[model samples]
Target: MLNLAPELAERGIAINAIAPGGTATDMAAEHTASYTPPALRDVPPEPVIQSMNALGRLAEPDEIATVTAFLLSSDASYITGATIDAAGGWI
Candidate 1:
């Protein structure tokens, strides 16, 4: 999606994709029951856990908000078609 930024800018249309890593939002907590531990793995990874991220912690909603604010403002006028990573190193 980010590769298309230059194209969008050429036509004067701003477009971007928000790539958020592991966030501690409500939706993530509800998906934990879907996994079952396989013997090869011994135990299931952290249940309802977003700990695999580089931060080893859940991301606050405010972090996403800040990215959103930046994306929507005039200050980001030149940042079209960019994928803003709001995740805490979940990538």
Candidate 2:
């Protein structure tokens, strides 16, 4: 994105990306399922998922949505050629 930023800038376009960690969504659920056997499906996945994150919890969909919204808003107009980490400080 940074490589093309200068060129895209002339056209009033901004390019950036977000790296979200451990978000609570269907894709995450499916990935988690592969890590656990069917016999353990009854167990809550929160604890397991939290253990993998520094924040000790998975992010809600709205949390990611908020970041996305901000990126699209004028508040982030000056932000370009960067990848925002929305991982709750994951290690």
Give the best candidate by TM-score. 2
Q: Compose the digit string of candidate 1's lDDT tens values, residues 1-91.
A: 6677677788887888788876666776555434544542455445434456766677788888888888889998888767887767773
Clashes of 1: 1
Q: lDDT of candidate 2 vs native?
A: 0.87
* lDDT (tens digit, per residue) of candidate 2 on 1-91: 8899888988989898999988889998888788888899899866776777788888999999999999999999998898999998787
Q: Which residue pairs clash in candidate 1?
A: 21-87
lDDT of 1: 0.71
Model 1, residue 63: C-alpha shift (Å)? 1.3
Question: Which sections of candidate 2 miss by over 4 Å?
Answer: 38-44
lDDT of each: 0.71, 0.87
